[model samples]
Target: MAVALPGVVEELLSEMAAAVRESARIPDEHLLSLKFIFGASAVQALDLVDRHSVTLISSPSGRRAYQVLGSSGKTYTCLASCHYCSCPAFAFSVLRKSDSLLCKHLLAIYLSQVMGTCQELSVSDKQLTDILLMEKKQEAS
Candidate 1:
């Protein structure tokens, strides 16, 4: 069987260009209008956050707080406010955009959903019971 040779750079470039054109529904002008602000350099960013996996830590009070990897200070924060991931990607998005529902820093939230880790898991038994009671009342209605 004969193997086809790799396409020439020109051919590859054309293919890439086509793919970009077809896949990129957003116009260059629109994309260019968005500034890319990042809190950390790419390398530093990688070290700080995990692309997958959400870890949960529980406080002594039995309040389970959630933690996803956050890129900051050349190391992962391990745990940060779910509302505010300390990763540079999050920082950049906050600085560059006014409304962002999800950024790379929100990977923890995604991971939590995927991994079925609840941010409220750390809540005290009384707190959890209260929540359950509230839910039950809502359901009964």
Candidate 2:
């Protein structure tokens, strides 16, 4: 199989996501594009959105982040602003091997934001810092 160009693939998915957000309509061809590119991750992203497992957390200090609840019941931190996800798939596939653009968790976050399906919550700045720190700690252990 030919090696996938992460930039081109991610750009396509991002455009499709933006189109879905603006149009509020899902075309069959868009779904097909996602399936062809992201494969199982695309299906999983839709499931995460359907399950309302994506959350946008905002702090009083004007910072925003995301949390994606996995099928295993674990919540992963997703920093969409920086395209970061604290998931094993991201670590292995995206960062380590460069085989994929983002993990299912990050994809779910994008889909949730575009479709207005993600939950939202507000918190203090301190809480936001703690949340980020906790993610780092988990990675250490």
Candidate 3:
């Protein structure tokens, strides 16, 4: 069965997808703390540090939104100005209870940026649509 996503969720997802399709590069500023707050996941995120695997996308016209494609094949969206990531770990573990600033995917983006391993791309609308369609198909199956 196909379930409809809420307006807010859909909006976030769309914004994330757009950002992912138009990403240039990870910024140089430190968006989160440098200390390793999370134990296993933090270490694990470091291991999955590959430029080809992760894509940091943001609008070219000064939009503050960001989306990161992690090595695990999951895309995480965030408003860089607000430091919010639309990931389960961010929603359940980071927000509303904790003071952490990043999930694994966000952390991966940060690491990739710092390590200078990010591959910049300008994705077309068709490509973005195709990627989203692929993800939906994978989820449906």
Candidate 4:
């Protein structure tokens, strides 16, 4: 079953889509900065850009989050507003070092947005809850 996207996720997607559509006008310096931070992952992210891999899941109370399923079949969560990702690279690198901005999963999301290839699917509240539980369990192990 399908559900409506939460306000925050919807807004974020709209903003990213607009930015992607207008990316041509973005400054070279900004592009260089992104390149510097994301490194080789920037190039790798492009290959993983697919609309079907990214989903927007929300709780019954309207809390929203993003899930990116990698080509490896692993799932990563991207939280709203903060841009934080639940990936090992994000935790070990981005969080440990302030210089970095994104993991491959997050980079893939950004690249997918810029390429106008991000597909958003809205899932049920129970699905969201189950995803969260699974994430927590994975972390614990």
Candidate 5:
């Protein structure tokens, strides 16, 4: 059964705007979250905007699924059978009362999804490079 992505565009854009606003705030706490989420050495969370932007790409095999790691430092299960993500952020958000479309965890997975899987495409330099070039062009154009 296909999971209905209702109001996906509106939700994604709303989430994007919230992320941008949070990035502009540049709170110390937010920076820590970025480091925790992205595993980047950079202190500013703003640096993640680039990474986040590229996280919407298709996974290998053309699956719509994306990947992400939870704050627990474990790989999230991209269960196609279930519409929900496994990260605490997502789990908590969904199980709780909230209207968020993409929690930070989902966004993290989105970033991971666009970045491609290390297990599969890590060595496919040619394909990875091609994908990166495509992403660059898409962003530039």
Candidate 6:
């Protein structure tokens, strides 16, 4: 899955990522910048990060997936490489009306990845495929 941030947002996020990667703390300016750009979405994403709801699942062959436990208690799978998330917000906001760039799940995943706070789980390739398939099935229903 790929991230769907606009070009300016993407560049800013990259800069924030670099700063966090080195300092292990989010710079206030960057945080403020995100808030200025994203409003409540940014705050919700920070809350998700605080909840530690983001997980990175990797297989032996390097296949990966991002799982986000929403406040609603349902797990959403995010394809960070493809910018896909099995969540209604992404479907409705990003793909349908184009009202937003991406959902909070995607933002949470990106921020957690940069902050090095995402929980990681290793599995076999088969297991990875199974997990992804289950998420997709849920989406269909």
- Which candidate should be chosen as best, given TM-score against the real structure? 6
lDDT-better candidate, 2 vs 5? 2
Q: Write the per-residue lDDT of candidate 3 for residues 100-140, one digit (tens) a residue.
A: 54576665655555555655665655665555466456545
Between candidates 1 and 4, which one is better according to lDDT? 4
lDDT tens digits, residues 1-141, model 6? 344668888888899889987887878999999888777889998899999999999999988899999989999998889888889989998899987777999889988877888999999999999999998788788
User: RMSDs, each prediction?
Assistant: 16.4, 4.8, 11.1, 6.9, 12.3, 1.8
What tens digits encode model 5's per-residue C-alpha lDDT throughout 1-141?
755444643344345446546663334554454455434322221333343422332445554433443444444444433456554555565567554444554444433333332223232445545654554465455
Which residue runs does candidate 6 get wrong by more than 4 Å? 1-4
Please give, for residues 36-106, the per-residue lDDT of candidate 2 as tens digits. Answer: 88889999989998999999999988898899999999999988877888999998998999888779998
Over 1-141, each residue of candidate 4 has an lDDT whose tens digit, in order, gives 333334544444465556567774334554465556567776566556743566667666787777888767888887744667788878888788765656777777755665556776667888888878888898889
Q: Looking at candidate 1, what is the lDDT of residue 134? A: 55
Scanning candidate 6 in windows of ten residues, the lowest lDDT window is 1-10
On TM-score, the stronger of 3 and 5 is 3
Cα lDDT over the full model 6: 0.88
Using lDDT, rank the candidates from best to worst: 6, 2, 4, 3, 5, 1
Q: Kindly report the root-mean-square deviation of model 2 from the true structure over all alpha carbons.
A: 4.8
The backbone clash count of each candidate, in order, is 3, 0, 2, 0, 0, 8
- Candidate 1 lDDT over 1-141, as tens digits, reads 222322442243344345446773334432232223222332232232234335554544654434454443122222334344444555566446744433544434433343334343365667545544554465456
Deviation from native of the Cα of residue 51 in model 3, angstroms: 6.3
- Candidate 1 residue runs with Cα over 4 Å from true position: 1-52, 62-64, 70-82, 117-141
Clashes of 3: 2
List TM-scores for all candidates, in order.
Answer: 0.33, 0.85, 0.52, 0.67, 0.36, 0.90
- TM-score for candidate 5: 0.36
Which lDDT value does model 6 have at 94?
Answer: 81
